[model samples]
Target: MRHVLLSLGILLILTVSSLTAQVPRRSFLFKDARGELAQARARGEMDVLLVIASMPDQNEQVAQAIAGLGGTVQFQADEVDYIRARVPVDGVEELVSHSAVHSVDISITGSRAFGMAADAPVLPNSEDFSASGILSEAVNPDTIIWPPVLSDYPITNRYSPLFDIRASEFLDSNPTYDGRGVKIAMIDMNPDPLLPELQVATDLDGQPIRKIGVYGTAQDLEEEDDGRWIRMEDMVTAADGQFTYGDNTYVAPKDGTFRIALFHEARDSLATFGGSLENDVNRDGNPEGSSRLFGVLWDEETDDVWVDTNQDLSFADQTALTDYNDRPEFGVFGTDDPDTPIRESVAFGIQIAQEKKLIALNLGSASHATLVVGAALANRGSEGRFDGVAPGAQLISIAEGGSAYGQIESPLISIRDHGAEVVYFEQSSNITRNYLLRDGRLVPTVIYERLIDRYDPVILSPTHNYPILGGIDDFVMARGLIGINGHESKENFFINHGVRVEHDDNLLITGGYGPMGNGALKPDVISPSNYVSTALGFIEGRA
Candidate 1:
């Protein structure tokens, strides 16, 4: 329910600064505003807010003044003394005259830009097909019975989202208006060849249905991993005594010792990246029963170094609870006290949590834009559950990996040169920011929102993020009903966070069900999904 994003060095507390001090516009301070205003005007938007930056101590007074001036504040960055608010269109000049104002510009936006840089150093390269999440192997295709024949929930496959919008109906009704002649353009890093269903159809506009193009963006502008996750690759391969482990003690040997590099044997295995301690190296569903983070112990007699799977300084001992205390005389094992939970200790539990947190802060999960395109355009083969709308239509894909101006402009060059009718985007957010190069330095910036003309396919999933919340629920689902370790149930079931308790008898319970905003559009639409396992054939390896 609370923000899971934990930052270490961020101290955003209020601090005083001189009222006369001027804060120069920095790229990180604000989004590209001038360009955004131009887009809003071109798109016919009215009463758009201008994000304002003020002197450190002037934020409060400026906010009150803005409120008095009929402007509603959307966000306030206390550490930076910035305010994003919707000011009156008629009083822009007058509001700019406010003494506390340092800079006034349109509110900018940021996006994941679809994963890491093009030459991403990580193993899951940007071009990896599976990273697209589009061409994933379907677990259930045939003989997997789906949704029961309920009264109101009749057959929905092959005729749901498309039929509701009459695309499929038109396809079945008449070929006259079919997308035979249309030249649709799509951009992605990797695209599956036109599916079998579209193999025969030709476009009426003399354009091929399988048209493809490439757009050039910055190769590796992404500075860090932003996936908010931790994987095996993120772990340190080598161990140093100078570095501290989770127990606040040095991981280093007495003074001159070093632990041999730790390596994840399952680096190439599917379904890894659960951070270290929380990772199920053995895949036994006993994640907390043991830890995967190992230290290297030198086998003096064998003349070899062995991986200490547990943080304990022993060789050839299993990391599981079963063999956790086998080498007690080495002082590396716990007291084997039945009363104390081994997982509760820092070396075993808290340290892993800290490592995982640090890892989540550094990972950059792959983008699924091409994946979305695959779900939207990929035609069904023998593995039938549902077919994308207008399977006969042509497609063009380009990988826009960066948010630079050249990167943003490169696609339009391809679109214009190729003569495209439809464009597909899966960058997650609608708005993207651009840095304005001024004088010689990159200063103020503005973000641009994609404008939907009559032709572009603007598909979106209707889901509000509760990422951490969902992870908690998922953990409970896998482990069973979590018992209350320290609090009440009616209101805050997730109070203790992820501390799990063992119990029998399966039961599903909802937490944070307190009334907030009761009504919202339910049943989000996922163009491509891996829900065949959960919802049967209704969403089988579907996209």
Candidate 2:
């Protein structure tokens, strides 16, 4: 009964999304879009409209129009007020010229453009030893709690969040709240339910906290015998390195137990760094080096640690570790219960969000997806650490997961339909910088003249440039990485967008492929784009 009521509530809020075309032809068509239109006609297809809706029912109304014209809708969003759809070539002009639409965009999504040339990604090996020292980082080696809370810092990822890691003053206030009735939904790949990190105790109020739903939107996709998406393994590889899926079940290190914690490797150490998997990212300089037996391998059962100096990945080539993995030994870890996907992995991401207090959704692979959400649930910690914000918050992962607004809608629905008080999603698209092609060039335009804004109390990660946190994504996307590109460290700290008030020689930010309107300086606040992130594990064989 509770589940049914919650589901219905979610359906009710979806009314905020309309289902027909109030197409404003001019808003949908590009300036002098003749060439593209002709090309579409020649190919018997048209470029998809990433529609920016202006009202509650507007999205649905416009979608109805597109379907009315026999077009296929790729994605929809009431959260950000937009839809990705492929309209009939012949109906392009008429559709865009319609009066009901506010804005439309032609994707710079091609081989030579902002999009990828191939589906398969070409990236650095993510194997533990691929990048030598970037394989792992020590986690809570001493079992010392970040905020001295036994329950706060217990995630098994090598890089877990500390008490005040979320921000400088985060610990000043009491977590007086435990997300008692709050529900959170992660719209990303499937999470391993078996991960000890995901185990949720009943709310402090004594109300049971467990999954109330599991909605899979990608029902058309094939699945493995375990119900994982047939493409789950491949899509994850497409995400990068040796990642893990299903549930993360890292063994909890007993008090006084030491462990070498490191995630897999990527080309840049920024993507993978912790413990003795040294990339010069030690919290206090010097990395506590291998001779100290701080190199990077942990034998949980034996309480053994090894350092890989030769990088051969064998204990023989390494030094036996007693060095405490050179990491803070703060968190708790335990074997996660055995986890199996209830459905395909991609679809399971959102579903799993429903049952836990927090979830880490990694969307680092899709440029399109990452443009808005890069490893969302990216909880960055101070002093080179990471953890989910609001650790005790309940997670509701029964929604579907994928790119586009449809992926977002599920979680939003979870909020409306369930007890999810907060949803920690990154973003669905970096559509803020979306432009209209005009006079052979792209013109910066705001087509969202008619949509409503979602002011959900969402804990957003500067993770993506999407509007998940309402204005944050637009602000960051407008001026992402002011100084450093993706991987530029400063003072031994991993920085993502390189803005430390002029630290590490990072002084420039990208801007202006098009002109602006209303003349508001974008990126309202440029706090700090640090690389202190919690890892989302989906390793190849960890399952």
Candidate 3:
């Protein structure tokens, strides 16, 4: 209660401030901004998050000056006292020199690192289904009981001592309090609202619960090359009685370290691009094989290409080819033997772009968001497996992109426009490597601090999966944020699926430890993360 009742709302801001109260306030000097300013100057212009002191006309004058210098105020949080702006590099020094500006740092809009796993496997839901309804192997579909008993999932029930949260008994006692009137906003990647497991029922008031409301504009959606496709006929050339591989313009890797390779549309197997003696790799065995398909592949590891020009299905006979800057096409062979062209494509690009495409198609973040929603409020009705912790809570999906500012902005919009009472963000605000956030004067830190004071919604975020002293970012270190730590369950500990299981409570090995530089614990709470069964998106199955 000591941390509650802030500003206009009543909220419990869980933080380890009591443990860090005695730490001295660190000071920032002009020299601290030198490195960042130099980088901004090199870029010509940059987006900056400025922590400004609450002064009379000073904040407005700073904004005016920034605008006059070819910059725009992107966002402003008066309560936490911060301003986000895109300022020209020539004027960044002038902007930072303002008396009202407390601290200056770059807004990491370009940072792509996220806490959510991008490659989480999409499991088949066939096993969890039956003609009668969706039921797990744990339950007897013939018997069909209502409000399933705890003994069903012998490994770890979705409730008490086994899962360690005790939601079963709590729901049994507080029937009306099972997230009845709450709106939980899942701020993560794209989540399909049509999934059966993620479907919404009704609220406590018996009003038909709306479908999971998807919010936000995906920044990458417009830039995505969804129309980039090559027909197989255009890729194959018939010369010398053998069909040879053609070429396409190469899309260079954004970073010099990587190059992507496009694959042929037809393949004999999923294991490798090459075919066997029994099968035609390029499907060129038939008259219509010329019209197959081709795709783009960019390998971030290497840029060299190796073609099996001899058609023996072995790269050992040939040498690696370079000079991609001059020629983008390679006349690969072995359309006759096993699908050697596919293998050559992989070797040529050094990685499978099609496999990367498959990963993107799977949409791990979407599946992850589905799991998060199901874990909170999945109720199968007569189709019984296990109910979520809050089976009656309303759900919303706020899809976000790579922008750091968009991350916070999405949740704020959810709370304001969609009436979200609880926001579960899948990404961490870890800008420690991008910019130093000393003394909690960073823009994200200030914005989070003020957001809680103004709205007082329950903001939940997972701590970065690192064990360093400052593993938790400075923004999450704000006074009122709830940082969550994922731990291993008894089932996961026994399964021993490569997890180190090395913590006081057998938590995750990569769980971030506490007592940051400011002496505050990184995570305010720990919860079970392993062995969770939830819905998958982009695929018609659940694991």
Measured against the true structure, the TM-scores of the candidates, in listed sequence, are 0.30, 0.44, 0.55
Candidate 1 Cα outliers beyond 4 Å, as residue runs: 1-159, 194-201, 205-367, 380-386, 402-407, 428-543
Candidate 2 Cα errors over 4 Å, as ranges? 1-26, 31-40, 46-86, 106-173, 178-180, 201-208, 211-387, 396-518, 526-543
Superposing all C-alpha atoms, what RMSD in Å does each candidate have to the true structure?
23.7, 17.4, 16.4
Quick one: how many clashes does candidate 1 have? 21
Q: Model-by-model lDDT, in order? A: 0.34, 0.34, 0.48
Using lDDT as the measure, name the better of candidate 2 and candidate 3.
3
Best by lDDT: 3
The candidate maximizing TM-score is 3
Worst 10 residues of 2 by lDDT: 343-352
TM-score of 1: 0.30
Write the number of the candidate with greater TM-score, choosing between 2 and 3. Answer: 3
* lDDT per residue (tens digit) for residues 77-154 in model 1: 444455667776545545666777665654332332232233636564433246555554654457555422322221
What local lDDT score does residue 175 receive in model 2, on the 0 to 100 scale? 51
